[model samples]
Every structure is written in C-alpha cells, then in structure tokens.
Target: MAESIPSDSPAVADDHHGHEEPSFWSKYVFSTDHKMIAMQYMFTGMAMAVIGGFMAYAFRMQLAFPGIEVPGFGIVTPANYNALVTNHGAIMIFWVAMPVLIAAFGNYLIPLMCGCDDMVFPKLNRLSYQIFLLSAVVLLSSFFVEGGGFGGAWTAYPPLSAKAEYSLTPLGSSIWLGAVALEFVAFLLGGINFITTAMNSRAPGMKLYDIPIVIWMIVIASILFLVSVGPLIAGAIMLLFDQQLGTAFFDPARGGDPVLWQHLFWFFGHPEVYVVLLPALGITAEIITVFARKKLFGYKTVLHTTIATGVLSFTVWAHHQFISGVDPRMAHVFTLTTLLISVPIAEMMFVYIATLYGGSIRLTTPMLWGLSFIAEFLIGGVTGIFLGASGADIYFHDTYFVLAHFHYTFFPIAIIGTFAGLTFWFPKMFGRMMNDRLGKIHFWGTIIPFNFIFIPLFVLGMGGQHRRIFDYSYFPELSMPWMQDIRVLATSSLLIMLGFQVVFFYNFIVSLRSGEKASKNPWKSNTLEWTADSPPPHGNWKELPTVYRGPYEYSVPGRDEDYWPQDQPN
Candidate 1:
C-alpha cells in the first residue's frame, strides 16, 4: 500500500494479501478462500459423522443384545433409545453425509475444476460453512438441555413433534425445529453460491460440454436444492409455530392436519436423496471414464438422465408418505411416480455398465469404488422398486425391509461415492497419491461389511419386523431366533465397517506427507483439472484453458494418445 503495488503482480496478489499473512482472525477464523471453507466443512462434517455413527452403534448395541449396557455410555432406556434414533437420523442424513458429500466436495472441487480463482462470492461461501457449524452446535446442544433433542424422528411428523406433552421434554421439539431451520438456511446459501459460480465463473472458453460431470451433477443438485428446499423451510416454520404459538399448522387437535407435515417433509425429503446421490453418481461417472481409458458412453444420455431425475424428484414425494394415511386415490399416482422415476436412474446405471464393456480397465482405488457403486446402487435402486409398489409397501412400510432398501441406496451413494471422489481426486487435493495397498484394503473392507449390514436388514424387514421399536421380545411370530442371528451379524458387520475407516484415515493423513508425488495428469484422463497443476494454486490455472472436446473423450479410434484432455485443441 505504501508503494501502491500493482494488483495483478505475483507479490501483491489480491486485496487481502500484502507483506504479511493476514491477521490470525482474518486468515483462519473468517477466511474467504474456497479451499479453507471446504476444509472447515469437511472437518465439521467428519465430527458430526463420528457423533452420528456412535449414535448408530449405540442403537445397534441395543438391537443386537437387548438390555445390554453400553460400556462407558451406560444403559439404553426407552426414552433414551427414542432420542438416539431421532438424533441419529437427523445428524447422519442432514448434518454429516449431506454436508460432507455435497457441500464440502462441491465447494472444494467446483471452483478448481471450473478454473475459477474462487467462488463468485467467497465471503458468502465462508458464511455458509459457519452457519452449518452453528446449526450442528445448536442441534447437539439440545441433548444436554432440559427436554433433550427432538424425539419426533427426522421426519418430525406432527402430533409427535408438535406437542410438548407428547414428547419426553417440553423444549425438545422446539430445539429440533430451530436446528433444522438453521441447517436449511446454511444449505440454501451454499446452493446459491454453487449455482452462481458454476454459471458465471468458468475459465475462458470452457463450455458446458467441457464441464466435468461431477460439477454438472452438483449444479443440477444445487438447482434442485434451491427449488425443493423452500417448501420444507416453510413447513419447518409452521411446525415451529404450531409448537410454540399454539398455531394449528400441523396440529390436528388445533384444526391443523398431522398428515400435512408428512406431505411437506417428504416433498423435500425424496428429492433430497437425489440431491445427495447425484454428486456421488457424478463421481462414479468421472472415475469410471478416467480409469476405463474410454470416453463416457452416452454422455448426453447420462446428462439428460440427471436432469430428468432432478425434475422427476419433486413428483414422487408422496411415496414416502404412503403409509402416513394419505388418501388412497393419491397413493396410486404417487406409487406410479415413484416406480417410474427408477427408469431414468436405471438408464444411468446402464450407461455406466455399458461404458465398462470392452474397455481397458485399470483397477485403481477409484475404479474399485466406481464398480462397487454400480453393484450397490443397482441393488439399492431395484429394491426401491419393491418398496414403490403400493401393495408391497402396505406390508413392508416402516419395516426393516424399507430400512434395508434405503441403507443400500444411502450407503452406496454416500460412502462409496465419497470414497470414489476421495480416491479420484486425492492426487489433486493432496498433491500426492494415496497408499494404493491401504486404499484397496479399505475399499474391500467397506463393500463386504456394508453388504452384510444392510442385507440382513432386508431379511428382517421381509420377516415382518418393524422399525423404531426398541425391543422385539413380544414379536415371537417373526422368527425371533433368526432376527437375533441377523442382529449379531449386522452388528459385527457394522463394527468392521467402522474399523476400516481407520485405514482410510491413516492412508489419507500419511499420504499427504509420504505418498508418491502425483503427476499433473496421473490418471491420464482428459479433464481440465488434470491439465492444470496438481493441488492447484490460489489461482487455478497459470493460463486459462480452452476446451475443444467432450469431458470423456477416451480411446478415440485415431487419437495418438489413449485420452484427450477436454481443453486440448483439436
């Protein structure tokens, strides 16, 4: 400032940077850098995952060995059991996996891949992370309060979530309402930043066609969030008012219909699955194309399928509420919408499988995760069709079968997809290759144990076991002995799944310092990020790249190399 250094000079950099590292508060606490914000989201999300996972482990201990004392955690009473179930679902689905997968990855990768200096509004991006953190803190804080966290389940269906008298603690329900509302606001701002940056901040000459599928999936998902989140936000406010101000928004006793909450919640909830799944699917698409040494088969088809799925997501909300006592006539329409939506999803999977055919496949860690996603998501999607059938749902609704179907879908999209993204982008994220041996071990450990955990849930569901019940002692007709056996296997599988993460964590942390140095284009794929520096600098590209090919132009018949970068000139 004394000499008025040029703004674009390397020494001068941007507005904030000068002779010294910005003050500790500006640098670490309120930083606007997308990368730092991403780290914030990642660490926060991981902490929440641990909390949520422990909750699941606690609940499973009870399920596997009923009346068992949970070591340092103490006994699992019924009220405590309900609290665990509700908070576990809320934290894992909303606060943990969703933020990590969508917000964290999306924030970190979108700017770098698109070749932008930073998000359009970097401060807003930072604010989003802070809001998410605040929401998590508020949510967790409720547990220590007088009434405990909300016990109405993640769905927060009325009469259950609405009335303080119905809940164990009078304030539990309101605390939950406040926490979810804050979380929604966090996502909304994050979504806005994503959409704005993607649409406006691409590197010079970078076209839509050249954009990575992962970014596309995120963009589409962001749009879905923007459109879908509003109704749920409105619903949450109404539910909160019903609890505090004695309004009848969702309170039947006060003239509000309890069923209204189900409609609003599922409206956002169903598409929310795709909102999480699309990014994972996009990761699968990117990893598969890079490792197969082949262009994505039917790239346009896959794009259309993603867009179609986003639109179709809004129409199928009622499928989740079929058993909530909605009108029977509307149920048929919902069932049709739910079952039919699977068509596009199935088509996308077909494209992935078709892409793998006759390709020179490199069985790297990312590819393993991609292949696992195909197998797991197929099982999840197909089983979802089973639940989509109104007839089957009438019997299976709220049963362990439904639980299994969702876990298959959820775990694959969440765990497998995240793993794929981590492996595929590890080089760029850390400037080094993850330990291949450790990675392979982690992959195998996750897939095998994951199957064991959820498949038994399906078996239990089909055997007529209901969900949310703390004890199965009374249900003697439901193959109690087999349920016991399944519970043991499931618990064992979960412990294994949880243990494998240690290997992943070790590999990730150690590799940052000791792993092999990654080449700029280690995977030999034709994406823009691969054309840039590994662990790209503050300003992504030294020179902005110009695009001339589709994202997956691998193994073209006459190409000199097996792959072509999207930015390479024809």
Candidate 2:
C-alpha cells in the first residue's frame, strides 16, 4: 500500500504542487513540463520507428523475393526501393533516434537529475517539440505529393537532388528540402534549451563534477549539435537554393561540384553518429555504476575521452568520401583521425568493463541492456576499424559489410540503449514499476534476434553484395546457392526481430496502468532525482536538493547504506 501526504505538506511545496489539475491546454496540448515534453517525443519517435521499420521491411522483401506480390501492399518496384531506402534512413536517424535519445531522454532526465524545476526556458522547449511535430507532418505529407517523397537519398546528394530534371518528382525534392530545414530548426531550439538548462539550472552545490554522467553526455551532445549542425544547415539551404532558385551550389553542369555536397553532408554526418552514441554512453554509465555496486572508475578520464571524441569527430568527416574522388591525401589524414577515435571509445569501454570487476552484479533489465550494449557496440566499433582503413574500405565502402557494421553500432544504441533508459527510468516516468518477468522476456527476445538479423548481413557483405540494390537474385555474382541460402536465413531472422518488438510494446503499455508501485529510490543509487518523490512533482524535488558529492559515490566505506544521494549532508 502507498502512503499519502497532505496537499499542504512541505514535500508538496518543495515539489511545486499547487495545481490540482491542469486545464485542457496545459495538461496535454501544450504542456511545458519537461516530462510531458519527453512523452510527446517518445510517441512521435515510436510512430516514426514504425514508418521506418515498415520501409525497411518493404525493401527487404523486394531484395529477398523480388516481383512477389503481397496482399494489401502492392509490388515493390526499383523506384519504390529507392524511396524506401531514403525514407528509412531519414526517419530512423533524424526522426526516431535523434528525437528519442537526445530530445526525449535529454529533456526529461536532465532537469530531474540536476534538481531543477523546469528547463531554463520552458516555453522554448514546448515550441521546439511543436516545430518537430510540424516537421514530421510536412515530411509524411510529401509521400502523398506529386512523384512522392525525395527518392535520391536522405543525404540528398547533389546533381541527384539539385535538379528537378534529374529527380523523379519536382515537388518531392522541394518538400524534402523544406521538411529537413524545419527539423533542423527544431533541433536548434532543443540544443539551446539543453545547454542552457544544464549550465544554469543545477541545484545548489551541484558543481559540474557532481552532475550525473548522463547529463554530461547530453550537454556534450547538445554542444556537438550546436556547432556541427550549422554547416549542414548552410549546406541544406544551398541545396534548396540550387533546387528552387536556379542557383548552382551542387549542380556541376551549372558550375558546381557534386562531391562538395558529400563533404558538407558528411561533415555533419559522422558527428551525428556520436550524437546518438553519447546518450547511450551516458545511460551505460548510469546503469553500470548502479549494477556494479561501485563507483565509476576513472571518472574524469571518461569525461575527457568523451570531449576528445567530440573534437576528433570533426576531423574525420572525409573518411566517408574516400571513394568519392576527393583528395587522396585527405583520406590518410581522415584514416588516422578515425582510428584515433577508437582509442577514446576503447578507453570508455574499458572503464565500464573495469567497473564491473568483482562487484555485486544484479542482472536487472537495465543492466541487461547495458551489458548487451557493450557486446553489440564492441562488434560494431571493431568492425568500424575495418572500414576506417582506406585499403579495406575500397572493397567494403558500399557493401553490406559497412551496412552490418553501422547497423551493429546503431541497433545497440538506438534499440538496446533506449530500452535500457526506458527500463531504468520507467518507474520515475510513470510512478509504477514495469513487470520484471515481462521485461526479461522483452530483453532476451530482442538481444537474440537482433544478433541473428545483422550477423548474416556481414556474410552477405563478404560475399560481394552491395547495399541499396533492389534484388540480389538478379545478379549472377550474388546468385550462388550459398548466397541464396543465407539471404533466406537473414530474411527470416529479420521477421523474427520484427515480431519480438511486440512483446516490448505489450509490456510498456500494460505496465503503465497495472505494474507495482515504485519506491522513491527504487535502485538505491546516489542520483539527485532518486531523492525526490517517486513520480516527482511538477518542479522535481520536494526541497531543491543541495548536492554534497559526485553522483556515483556507491559503496563508500563509511556510509550506512551502499549508496548515498547527492543531497545528503555529511
């Protein structure tokens, strides 16, 4: 049974509990609270995931069994494959991962963990979400427009994307350009909010050192988005001008270089991967500390490594353009920077694994996701080394090997890390604990099938199959019996992977209403948010927590409990 406090209690006051109920607009439509904004991001991201996943499946079907007609959905054509690939990349990266990891988790967790009442600028946060929603609507609406959405690619490479003559749809390319601009603006707004809130809103005594690793990652990611996104925004504007205003920024025939677009795009693109990885890194830090029953080892080293990773991310953008006929000298430079990136990443990984040495390990759902992240991310990161080598990249650049490597990296962060954050914070988010049994089922099912889906993709790449092709069976080089057998197996694994998500969906929705009530500090960790109410009030903490130490001070020798909240005075 749960105990209740009076409305006039100091706890209520400290938590900013004045309103009995919000009116129509405040409650849902234009909520200013960080938590509500996070929920809005989650729902929107999930919707985009469905759209992106369906697009992937559609393309996959065409690749495995070409010219096969299924009920309700019509035949998948070559042009349709192009469209699916474009929309899939755009939706997954920009809409699903960016919004879910950075916007949603960053917004919700930052204020709560830092002991702040709201984002530094609440109304601005609301506006950012609305703008993102508007951007998604505009993007989806493009599919219904003349010639459908932009089919060139999500990167919208020039010559391909700059001319209406080269594009399949006149309106599709324009809408793609416009929709992306809107989404960029949305992120810009969000980036400002994240940086400002992290810097300005931390509770008294909560120095930068005392903040949680998750906040640090988010703050760094925000800075990355701020500095890195500007070039892409400039490039997007130039591409739009070339497409619409008779300019020649990327139109080679009109005195522009097609390769220039790749430079501008990948300049932002590689850092974008770190933008996704950082939040996952933050969640990993939090979970590893709690589950290991120990403080994070080499905390400052991990922080500096993340900062170094961000700085090095800018220097390695040309690696993606190695085959695009850019300066060969630049390739060696990029190769060095790209490989150097792994050192910092490896340092961080070693820290997590070292933290787990000889500690009490509880195989909770969040910890399971964290451990799985290490395994899956390692496979992804190690394989990335293969691509970083210009010699090896020559054969594998556009091959399924590259696809497998990135998918390995992305799935763990986007799927596993997101699930880890969800499982770890579900109690605080919803005021109820998710069913442990159901959570375990969701975890194992996903981890097994996820590996199944991508591991064979490596084989496909090794067999000389290229990515973005509609049909594998059409090419005799790829039509060998062994290749065909593996294609079928891989396709089956993908379907199983798709089915496994249903268990997660069921657990998430059902547990919201019926799961066990959670304690305020369910995980017994030394984070500020845990010191507050279970489902923290509008402001967050009852009395604003005055931090006394770093966030990961678990198992301190003299402490009565294994962990201590940051707010507890000596």
Candidate 3:
C-alpha cells in the first residue's frame, strides 16, 4: 500500500520550507525537538557517568589499599568511603542508566521507529528532561551540605536512614530522598509521553506487530516503570517525613515496621532491574538481526517472553529478603519465584543465540557488544541461581560475591548495552560513521580488563569477603594476604577498564567533527529511522514514511537487495 511521495507532499518538503528558523536558545536549550532533547539527556548522562566512575575509582582504591592516600581523593575516611559507595550506586542507576537508556533513547527512537514526526506531547518531553536535570543538581548539592551525603547505602533502610543521629547526615539524607523523588516524577512524565506517542502516533497502516522490537521494548519498560514506581514513591515520602518531620513510619521504637521499607523498596527495585534491562535486550535484538542479515528468529515469541519476564519480575522481589528475617515458608515461595523468573530470561538469551545461528555475521563493534552482553549476562544469571536459593543466600548475602554478580549484570546492561546502541545509532544521530577500529580497540580494552576485575571479586566472595566493610585489614578473617591480593587485582583491573573509556570519548569527538559522511542507510537497516536522512532534519522526514512491511525484512527471496525498508513498497 505504500507509494512514493510526490514532490509537493509535506513529507518530502524541507522542514524549514515554510517556517521561521528557530533561535539558538530555543533550538539548543529549550528545544521541543525530540532529537535535541535526546541530545540533552545523552550528554547529561555521560557527565553523570564520569562522576559515578570517579566515585568508583575513589572507593575501590580505598578497598584495595585500605588507607593509602588515593590520588584525586586524598585519604578515604570511613565516612567518605561510605558516601562514595552510596552515591556511586545512586548516581549510576538513577542518573546515568535510567536517563541514558530510557529518556534519551526513548525520546529519539520512539517517534522515528514508530514512523511519526514527533511525540504526541512534545512539551511534556522537554519538561521531563528539565526536571531530571534539576534532580541531578539536587543530588550533587547534597554532598556539599552539612555532614556530607547520606551513608546508609543506596537502599536507605530505616533506623539508619530515618534517624539523623544514626545516619549523621540529617540534611543530606532528606536531600537525597528529595532528589530521588524528583527523578521519579521526571520519568513519570516522560513515560506517559513514550506510551502515548507509540500508542497513538504511528504512521497509517502500521499495526502492532509492525512496530520495531526496540519500540516495543521501550514501551514495555515505560509501562513497567509506571506500574512499579508508585510504591517506591510512597515509601520515599514516608522516609523523608521520618528524616525531617519526626515521623516514625519506619522507626521500630515508635511502633513502626522497619521491614515495610524493604518490601516497598524491593518491590520497585527488583523490577527496576528489568525496567532498565528490557531496553538493552531490545537494543541487542535490533543489532543482531541487522548484522546477521536475518529476520528475527521468532518475533512474537520474543515479545511474549518479554511480557512474561516483566510479570515474573514483580513476584520475585522478596528473594532479596531471604536473610532479612522473612519467614521460612515465605522465603521458600520467593525462592521458587526467583528461580522461576530465570526461565523466561534464559529463553530470551537462547533466542538471541538462535537469531545469530547460521547467519552471515558482521563482527562490528556494536555486534561485539551485543554478543558480549549475551555471554557475560549468562554468567551473571548463572551465579544468581546460587544466591536465589534461600539456603545459599544465607551465606552469600552482603558479600563480595553479591557485589560481583551485581556488576556482571549491571555492567553488561548499562555500559556495554549503551555502547552497543550508541555506536549502532551514531551514524543516524549524526551524519557520520564512527571509527570501527577505534571502537573495537575500546571494546577489547574494556571487555578483557572487565573480566579480570570481576572474576577476582567472585573468588573473594566465595572466600567470604563482606561487602560493607571499608577496611578488611582490621578484620583478621578477611585480612589474609590472598584475599587482599584479590582485592588489589580487582581494583587494578577497574583502573584499566576506566582508562580505556578515554578511547571511546576520543573516538566520539573525532567522529562528530571529521569522520566519513554517512549515507542514509549506512548499515542497510530496515527500520523507519534508517529511511530518513542521517542526522534527520528537525521534522525527521522530508515526507513522512509509510510502512509497507515489518522492520526486519532482510533477505527476502527474488529481491536484489538483501534488506527491505519498512517504508518501501513492493
């Protein structure tokens, strides 16, 4: 049904054909252009990633050396160590991962992939990023306030987080909570825009299955966030009241239940894993299919399994509470659910492998990252099985094993997945191709050292290294030379991994200014975004595209082209 547009059609007309040129401030700063807003979120997230990385470097130095003066951080006081670890966790998950994966990608890709010019509520999209920026500023400001930032860990459990005397950061604790609350609000607005636009703004004739996998994944993630965030917001409000208004919502001495916070926190926290994860999984799906030159192995199956994963995510939150005084019977139920949730996830992984099977594969940088995600996340998933067992969890909880497992999963999701999506899309976002040699160099530099870092921690975790202690040397059981050596190895590898990020930044800047110019379909991708101009114009298309087939129609028989774009008619 698709037809080539006539020259006079608005879809083919230049974006500025009839409109005034936007002022610099409106175009760059307060722009309602979804692409510009995406740029804002991307740059802000990159800045936060740098801050989070420094926090990791500072604390890891303290862990590996136990009192050596760390460069750029001075001596790591116990309080400073705690603050660094807490804020690092908070910033990476909240400011860096969520904003980059959801807000940045969702805003840029949703309308384009769904074959629309812009979001249904463009102003709401801009407001979302503004609020998110404010939230980041608020969180950073907390460190300079009285008593430094909150040190009760990222979870902010009660008694410690509720009572300022116990937490020793009366002002910081409240400010941290406020910052998180504001972030949730920003995403709430953004989520609505994502869902509404994808639902209502698709080009004519684009059906549900016609939607790209990434669009579906982003929408699912947004829905999951909207549904799961309510309880956490309520819990944060109560915690804030406890910190400032003398409320005892979590104070056991005041007839409050401290455990209530855990339930509320994990309820959101566990699903939040998938909230960020689904999009990464979606990113991999898109990349693997294009590079493999194959149709997705089973499109609907992947979709249904993703839904299954999201549903199962809610039931397994209590696995985290196995050692928190949960009843044995309750723990048994949660353990079953935790292990059960792995089925759909593992199925999804197998699906990716199957998609890659027997296809002509290109080992491009994005493909390498996509491939690495499947391999590394498998290790994270397998190790998580031991921790999911209630009996084993009793020994492993709060240990370095848990820490290593957490990073194996998160690093793949946040860092590797971001790189995959970014490199794959760079040509489209800017009218240029990234240096593949530099990209692969950064990839190997990051991946090899990454394993060295976490594998040592996994071993130390089995050797019973607790995660919370700032100085293991004081505890004779943990101070064994071998254990200390492993800590130093992990920290050293972390430095290597962090050092290679310089290659990525260098490549990014050089590519923007001087890389080879990109053709519209550089990767021969079939998605709607590819049909538009590279660095698509303000309105995206000279004329909007009309969908004629699904997004992954590679290698259709009797056609000279190996790929068929969504907007191309037979």
* lDDT-sorted candidate list, best first: 3, 2, 1
> How far is each candidate from the true structure, as Cα RMSD in Å?
3.8, 5.0, 4.3
| Candidate 3: residue 25 Cα off by (Å) | 0.7
Q: Write the per-residue lDDT of candidate 1 for residues 1-570, one digit (tens) a residue.
A: 112544444222233433355688876678877777877887788788888888888889888988889865678888888889999888878897779888988988887778776777665677788888899989998888897767667888878888888886678778878988999888988998898788877877778777888999999998888898888998998988888888888766667788887878888998899899999999999898889887788878999999999989999988887777778888899888888798899899999999988799999999999999999988889899888988888899989998899888888877788789878888987789999999999999989999999998898988889888887886777646877999889999998999898999899889989999999989997877787788876556767676676778888898789987777777
Q: List TM-score per model, in order.
A: 0.95, 0.95, 0.96
Query: Lowest summed lDDT over 10 consecutive residues: which window, candidate 3?
Result: 10-19
Please report the candidate that would top TM-score against the real structure: 3
Please, what are the lDDT tens digits per residue for candidate 2 over residues 1-570?
012544344212122334567887887878878889998998899899988988877777766677887334579877777888988888888899999999999988988888888886666788899999999999998888878778897878888898878877788888877888898899888889888888877888988888798999999988888888888898999988988898998877768888888888998999999998999999999998998888999789889999999999888889999999988888899899999999999999999899998678999999999999998999999999999999899999989999899999998888788999999999988889988888898888888878877899899998879988887767899978887777777777777878878988898888898888999989988888787787887777557778889998888898689987888896
lDDT of 2: 0.86
Clash count for each candidate, listed in order shown? 2, 1, 4
